[model samples]
Target: MDLLANLVLGFEAALTLQNLGYATLGVVLGTAIGVLPGLGPVPTIAMLLPLTYALPPESAVIMLAGIFYGSQYGGSTTSILVNIPGESSSVVTCLDGHKMARNGQAGLALATAALSSFFAGCVATVLLAAFAPTLASVAFKFGPAEYFSLMVLGLLGAVALAHGSVLHAICMILFGILLGLVGTDITSGGQRFTMGFSELFDGIEFVALAMGLFGLAEVISNAGRQDDRQLVTKKLSGLWPSRADLRRMTAPAVRGTALGSLLGLLPGGGATLSSFAAYALEKKVSKRPRDFGTGVLEGVAAPEAANNAAAQTSFIPMLTLGMPSNAVMALMIGALMLHNIQPGPQVITNNPQLFWGLVASMWIGNVILVVLNLPMIFVWVKMLSIPYRYLFPSIILISCVGVFSVTNDVFGVFLMAAFGAIGYILLRLDCEVAPMLLGFVLGQSLEAYFRRAMLISDGSLWVFVERPLSAAMLILAATIVMTFFIPTLTRKRTEVFREAE
Candidate 1:
């Protein structure tokens, strides 16, 4: 009954004209971005972070949330039509989606993606609303020891699930933590690695790092690549699936949604990971696995469903525990901090309207995505005709302007440029920077929790081990690290990612 009442309050807040408008705008822009190959929501969201400042907190989050999930709907459109994945999560969709397009089933492939994503998204939202408060209640019982242990587990999970070499991922994590430690010491009132620069005293800007590492660096990397795509069809037909297709889609969609909802709660597990795993799972369980890359309906349904489900449920940890499960969630945490809202267990108790309103907004946004994607498919298809070269310059310009708007300081621009160069260099080295971004975002919080735990325990190290919750987290963290040391798991990890590639 309380849940029903809270949901009613949420609908009241989200149904306002202003909130609805922002949600619509966000889905529209998100779909546009997703239709453009080689563009993903992370950099786009980072580039637009400054714009959210003009909005009320509820509206700001609602729009941003819409963008993140709506992109999943847009991504599969290009994957089927042009054989290009607009988002990394759509990579698996390209396998079967493009084959279907080549066989003149483009409309069926696209409709499958849209319908699967919508169903998964609706289910994931329900799970989030029902489970978020329950998890947050557990958070209320946590001490600093548990928090610190939880962070350790999270950082380890990021490395474990990373794409390439675990050693390289660990190195990036360490580098990010070191970068995070470059500013003034909060407790000692003394600088650690400021190097006499007044700007360094405050620490590197999160927006600058995000822009440089993802936005500017991506533009540089994408500058030379040319889009050679030829659309399969401009006018889609056969809008509704046949009964046979629906029967084929049903089980895979359910399985994908379940995988996504569970994996989305783990650190570093997001849409990309969920989609790939779901596609692989479908292949593994198929009666004839050879049909997987040959325009099978299940292929389009499973991955699309998984990615959208993961995108929705990944918010659980960030909203309830203030622990980001991925890079995008880290940015969402930054957005909340900008509004002076500390995201954690107290977020529900202290700001029920904001929490419930955001939840309701997601449900509304999914419907908006389904409506926009099916009717406006041609508009998105035409957008693919724009050359990659034309988009890069505009993206670079927007990024610079957004970073400058932060503090009106030229120093921020210089800092961004430096990180951009560094980001490009790292990309060339084949290093995944997502783990680094996660480390930088969580470093300070992890340190703070650790120190507080130590202080409270009168300098006793056993406090962490004494608490069952913290001890279990640490044990899991240790187990994760140890798994990589084994040759079998290491080889298998390489094989899994290699197959993904």
Candidate 2:
């Protein structure tokens, strides 16, 4: 009953002409960005953050939220049309989705992606409406010590989820922490890590850093790889799937949605993790597991559904609990705070329209997304025909413009170039960047909570253990470390995942 009433109210709020326009604009921009290589949600959102200051908070957030999920919707398009994945969550899609495209079923694969994502988004939106307030209530009880511990565990989980050497991830995290310290120190009344530059007083802008690291670095990397093109040249037919295809996909989509919604709430990995988990689950549970990676519709549907579902549910923690699971969430957190709106249980009660309106907008956005994508498939496919040389340079220019736009400083552009070089080096060396990005976002918040907890407990480190929740979290972190380091358990888990084939 409560959820029903909120949805009604949300519809009322989101139905406004202006808000609807923003939503449309957001989804369109998101789709375009997703179709273009080297652009993702984080930098795009970061670039747009400044513009939101002039709009109504509800409208601003609605637009931004649309961009997030809209990118998710568009990511599969690129992955299926080209071998390139526009978003990290779509990485697994390239495995089977591109194969399906190669087999001249590009239309069917795209249609599956569109429909599955729409269904997942709708289901997740309903879940968000139902549970956000209750979850927020639970989050409100967390004290500084508990929050600090949660962040510690979050950072650890991020490192564990990273694709490469844990040691390198840890080092990158430390570097992020150091970079985070460059700003003015509020506690000590002293400048830290300014390196004697006057502009350093304001600290390095998060927008600049994010755009540089992700947007610019990706552009440079893609530019270097232009000569190596892998795209599907076959014409496509049958925008709608056959009855048999639907029957096969239904179970996976449902199961994937459940798994994704649950995993999306976790502090790290979220959508990306959910996609991988869904792939593994479908492969394990399917009657013919050997059919995977060979253009099976379920192979394409499961991960696509799961990742999109997770992407929607990820808003729960950021909006209701003030806890950010990833860099994108961190940016959203910053945006919410910038609007003078505090995230957590209080938000639902104090700002019902903003809460419910955002929820409502997601459903509407998904509907629009499905309708828009079906007709735009040909357009997106045509995008693949553009020469990589021309497209990549424009992307690099856009990235530099975005970086400079954030700070209006040439130094920020220089910083981006430096990070691009570093990113290229890390790529060659097989180092993980996601963990570093996660650490950079959480470092300051972790430090702030840690200091606050210490102040409250008179510098007693045991306070973390004394608190039941914090203690449990610490124990879980320790367990993960122990399990991963133990040769036997690590081998077993790895073998289990591999056996799903």
Candidate 3:
């Protein structure tokens, strides 16, 4: 009954004229951006962070949330038509989706991907709604030590589950922490890494750092890329799936949803991991494994479903425990903080309207995606025709403009450019910037918690070990780091991501 009432309250809030408009606009923009190859939500969201300051907090979050999940739906289109993944999570869809398209079943593939994503999204939203409050309630009991330990676990888990070497990821995390420590000491009012610059006094601008690392860096890398994409088919017919198609997709979609929902709750887990795991699971379970990559509808349905489900459920930790599961969630945490609303369990009790409305908007956004995708499919296909030359310059200009708006100063743009160079350098070194970003995001809080814990315990350092929950989390973090060194586990971990790529 309480759930029903809360849902009713959610719908009522989400149905407001202002919130609905924002939700619609967000889905539209999100789908548009997602259809573009190589431009994922990270850079896009980073570019838009400054712009979000002008909007109401609820509307801003609702729109950003739309972009995150809506991108999952749009990525499949690019993978199916051009055999290019718009987002990393959609890479698996290309295996069967493009094959289906080449076989002149582009329409069927698109319909299957879209419908499967929609179904999975709906299920994930329900799971999010049912489980998030309970998780948040549990999180209400956490203190400084617990919060600090949880963050440690999250950071370690990110590296343990990421797509690169654990050592490199650890280096990036340490580097990010170094970056986070560049300003005046919070406890002591003395400059540390200012290097005689007045701007460094406030520390690195979050907007500039994020925009540089993700937005500018992406542009710099993609600016020289050649576009050799050729569409498999321009004319899409048979937009509806057959009864056989539906039968084949239903089971995989359900299974994918279940797997994705669970994986999405883990630290460093999101659409990419969910989709890969789902594809592997389907291959393992299928009776006709030999036909797995020959344009199977189940293949198209499963990963697409999993990625979207995971996209929705990834919000669990971010909203409830304030732990960012991935780089994107880290940005969302920044967004919430910019709005002056602290991320954590208090978000539920202090801002019921925002919480419920955001959940309701997710379901509505999925409905909007289905409506936009099937009938308006041609619009997205047409977007592919636009050349890279025009897109790159425009992106760079908008990013600079957005960065300038953050501080109303030229220094911010310069800072962004500097970070863009750093981001490029890191990219060349085969280092993932995500762990660095997470470390930067969590560094200050971690330091504050550690200091506060020490202050409470008279600098004994045993408080973390003394608390059962904190000790357990620290042990888990240790276990995660240890697993990567084990021969069997190391090989298995490498294979899982390698299979996806």
Report the poorest 10 consecutive residues by lDDT, candidate 3.
492-501
| Best-to-worst ranking by TM-score | 1, 3, 2
Model 2 per-residue lDDT tens digits across residues 235-303? 778889999988877888898889988888887667777888999899999899998888889988888
Q: lDDT tens string, model 3, 236-351? A: 99999989989999999999999999999888889999999899899999999888789989999999999999999999899999888898899998888888988899998898
Q: What does candidate 1's lDDT look like per residue over 1-501, in tens digits?
A: 989998998888899999999989888888888889878889888888878877898998888888899899999988999888999899899999999988889999999999999999999999999999999999999999999999899999999998898988999888888888879887897887788888878888888898899899999999999679888877789878999999999999999999988889999889988999999999999998999999999999999999999999999999999888888998898788778899899999998988899899989999998988888888888999999989999998998888889857888888888999999999899888889988898888888898999999999999999999999999999999999999999998898788667
lDDT value, residue 478 of candidate 2? 83
For all predictions, the C-alpha RMSD in Å is 1.1, 3.0, 1.2
Please say which candidate is ahead in TM-score: 1 or 2: 1
Compared with the true structure, all predictions reach lDDT values of 0.90, 0.80, 0.90
Give per-model TM-scores: 0.98, 0.90, 0.98
* Candidate 3: residue pairs that collide: none
Stretches of candidate 1 off by over 4 Å are none
Residue 476 of model 3, lDDT score: 94
